[model samples]
Target chain A: MDPYPPSNELGATLGRIRGLVLTQETAQHAVDLLAQVAQETMPNASGAGVSLIHEAQRTSVGATDALVRTADDLQYDLGEGPCLTAWATRSPVMIEDTTTDQRFSRWSGAAAEAGVRSCFSVPLLRGRDSLGAMKVYSTVPGAFDEADRARLTSLSVAASALLGHVQTSETSTRISSELRESLRSRDLVGIAKGILMQREGLTEAEALAALTARARSTGIPFGQLTADIVNGHGASGRRGAP
Target chain B: MIGFPHAEEQRALINAAVVESGFTVGEVWLHYFSLSGEVDEYEVEAYLTGLMPLPSLECDLLALAVNELIDDLPPRRRAPFSDELIRSHAGSGDAE
Candidate 1:
């Protein structure tokens, strides 16, 4: 048998977590549930939250309470704390006693005053890409032991998987939007090309070249110039004959 | 302060701009690089024609990188720098 007795209800907990991940809930709801799972699974954790880092933006989701949110916000505002460190370095960061942790003294002091005496964070990662981080905080100092770390780390795997799914979905939606935009631009340019081809008696490629040249010479964007042509404005009017 | 230290992150911004600007990635790259003095118009044309055309997204990313590099240059130098880019394009006659 495994030497470490199950600290929480592993089987039931995993089943519920799997339902949360696999169900059709919003990404935020899933993230909140994951935080709840962390708080429930780790006996030392008094509160839990997930910090999402996208490009230059940081947001805290599913903080168990206001104190948990405050603890997270302090780290983001200072740009130093276990959660940010975990996201940056893609490793688990443990602050056994925030008062004595000199690495992030300002944030540590703020967090301590907020009643968070200790914390642990693990990055939600997929290969080299970091999805974000999951942080658990406690009012008692030196709250997390190795067993707690092991438990949270395992939970973070589920967190990463769900977060990765959400990331892919968002990316797809963005790409679809971009594709629509590209097509609209293409349509306008194509019509402009046709108009130029017929009016100026030039080949399709030549008409396109002319439009691009005019866009550059006038400092108007290529799409805008083509749009003007479709609307019978600007360069097409200047050309007089076309 | 505006900073894009990671190349991938910079590329992503460039890709968005390329899509939004409706400029082919190659043209944007040539314009950006010409502005930065990193590559001349002829070199960009040569690279584009001799090799398979770069995907438009990739070209935009490279162009964006050049733009960021130029932004980091001294403000007083920016005007003359853009003037040089215009001059270089005038010299090239749409070779790109």
Candidate 2:
């Protein structure tokens, strides 16, 4: 049955899951929680997995059952399957008839050989952008009903929110690094300009103009010129020599 | 003729699979897989002819397509070739 919005019984479980999610900080831990939700709700399901995809490639972060692990591995290795489609399209993929499905026609045989019959995938998206996917596999046909789909969609939403936060954190880190580097470069640039003014008896603007001219003439970078000055310059302020 | 397996995976076959399923083609498709190793086409055809009861144009085409797929398979796995391949020149391979 689909477990959406949670009845009292499921509400308690959802509460527990939500509490646990609040307790963790790492993206990997969030992925594990998504897998746990899929596996717990779908008892007949053989495996549950979570994946992070960016630029068309997928990396699995967590797996709940051996079957799910295998499915995730196959998707990673094959690069085409329900989970791949879900992640790429940022939509839910329900493979009710795995055996007859042409998508399965390729991996279906191998997956069948490995004991999986049905698969359902929901994208973990960051508002129209798919950051990852959550997937569940079963040994029975039509195992994912409407209720299950709804339950998974909500869980996927929760996962998407967390994953979006993680991706944002990563972006913040990159921005901070660039800002630090920019600040450092400006500090060094100031010193180099000060050196130019002191040695050439020029104002700040004149020193900057001289440095720019030298940089252009020698085909050396301004940063390189400043570094050379810092390391005790040569006659032309080139990198090598005193 | 001279490319990776991904060259084949994105084949018109993807659309064909979507169109063929639950329609003209039956559920069970028997492929004569000859991995350039043990099995041969002649032996596979002989086996199919002997075992199957139905005889029609649809069956013939199915048999040919299956055999063609089997022939297309490399000595190695198909998934990696499909997965590992990228657009050689971001659109060059398809254009060529």
Candidate 3:
């Protein structure tokens, strides 16, 4: 039997976490829960932060105080901080002495400014695709241990399950946006279609067909076709010139 | 603020969904990269949107944006379909 009770508690917590992530319904609700989990489980950490990379860009929103938030934001904005590197490399990043970590070529200054004495960041990825990172900060050096990293890595798995949803939801929002823009421009395209219908004697569908075909055939695009129709009418002073 | 970021996110999600759907990430990325960027934005949008067949938060956001656009448009005028009228009341709003 393991002599240390805290280590056993950490393992039990990690197992419970995996089970929760496997069944959690949505991603939005999971973020807050994970924040709470980090606070209660990580003993030495004064605060926690989560940074997620959706697409190629970085988006990190955290639940820490002003100082840790500042440090985490620095890592996110510069893309050179310990947590980001840890997440990218899918390994444990330890800053035993924040004021003295030589590996942090550029991050040392800002971290010093943030008054961070030590830092640790772990990747939230399963294999190759990184979901994001879980970072913890402390005011004292030598604050973390191997058991802490193991527990945090398990936490990252749960966090990924949550982020996977945010990412998907975000993507869904983007496509919806493109669709909306398509619809918004539809009237103009429709007017262009209407113009083509009036001028070339084509129906709505036929006008769209003509525009699409022209885009394909001429190596131009439908939006350009729509623009041409509008601009051409404006230039020609023909009927329905607007 | 919205277009590029969101588009990129959707592409990532599409890759993930495909990975979940049982294809290799490298293969998918290679195929996606090979597609010409010259394709119409609408076509590319359709392709990405098609990859994930279910409605999620993005659909809601799109609806919100559309509703906002439609709401912000000036009330319809009784004027004829003249060039001046179309140019003047063409219903422009925050798209990007």
Candidate 4:
């Protein structure tokens, strides 16, 4: 019989573990599918793009065509565009005509040159956090109306819910690095405990207590102290007392 | 649940220290996992909250993880005496 009762916390922990196993490729695939859906949702759009941004950097981008990719690239490269503004402001951004729009002059000029005359971007939001942005680009001005805007906004809400459980590249990298450092420190403590046990003829508990005592009394950090012990440069001469 | 002497008290103290040290359950679980503690993060959270029991050895390892994290916290600011401040600043130029 299982002793532990099932709870929401357990479900969340399992979800996180599942997220860790899912790779960046899976996230890319999901975004690519979302981008296609966004394009199909708006027939008048020339192309569509979905971007997953982390810390102002594009971690992944899914676009329907070369034009979509180029237009999205210009936004990140110029560091100021409708999509980025939408992500930052946690709202929808509409550029009626890139040729005449005053906002994001550099981005608009470049995007317009690349054949993007109008754009509508909506932030993919999960609760208080903005996951990224989804947008559609059109060659003609005023392509997206209030109805299209509403449709894209609802699409982003669904996309955000799906993407929220997916781990970004940056997050997985940080988690693995932290896990590695923690394992190394834990290994050192184990080796140091073995040394104390062999030399002091103490039980496992006693050895751990001794290590903790030494760390407290000498004001040495536990990891550094254990490292010294394992390196044979600590507590070698004075070992009679338990 | 496996019964261990003083398990509840130990769990309570560990939970208190974890709260005071401002470490999250995920953080504590990471360290405890590194130390070869076998319980999953969810179960560890349960143990810390006294909603469940953990084996004595695992409990000790969790305690060790919390204590180590507490030790790593930055020391609190101390008000220095006038003479101590002067001597510290006075010695900075030639101490090396």
User: Which numbered prediction scores highest in DockQ against the true structure?
Assistant: 4
Q: Global lDDT for candidate 4?
A: 0.82
lDDT of 1 by residue, A1-242 (tens): 22433323432232232222223246677678888888999878899998667643473367888899999888778878888889888999999998899989999999998899999999999877887899899999999999999999999998888878765543332233333454466677778879888888889656756765575467665666778888987556335634
Model 4 misplaced stretches (Cα beyond 4 Å): A1-19, A168-242, B1-4, B7-28, B31-58, B61-96
Measured with DockQ on alpha carbons, how good is candidate 1? 0.02
Weakest lDDT window of 10 consecutive positions for candidate 3 chain A: A15-24
Order of the predicted models by lDDT, top scorer first:
4, 1, 2, 3
> Which predicted model would earn the best lDDT?
4
Position A203, candidate 4: lDDT: 90
Once fitted onto the true fold, the runs of candidate 3 whose alpha carbons sit more than 4 angstroms away are A1-30, A55-60, A76-79, A86-92, A126-129, A170-200, A209-242, B1-96
lDDT of each: 0.67, 0.59, 0.57, 0.82
Worst 10 residues of 1 chain B by lDDT: B30-39
Clash pairs (backbone) in predicted model 1: none
| lDDT (10s digit) by residue, model 2, range B1-96 | 224344333334432542444221211122211101112333333333343222232233333334344434455654645434555455566643
Q: Report the C-alpha lDDT of model 3 over A129-225, residue by residue, as the tens digit.
A: 7776778888888788899878887888877776776554443333333334443455456567677788767776566556655544565444555
Q: After superposition, which runs of candidate 2 have C-alpha atoms over 4 Å from their true positions? A: A1-25, A170-242, B1-96
Q: For model 4, state the Cα shift of residue B16 in Å.
A: 14
After TM-score superposition, the amount by which residue A209's alpha carbon in candidate 1 deviates from its true location, in angstroms, is 11
lDDT of 4 by residue, B63-96 (tens): 8778878877889999999999779988787653
How do all the candidates rank in terms of TM-score, highest first?
Answer: 4, 1, 3, 2
TM-score of each: 0.49, 0.46, 0.47, 0.59
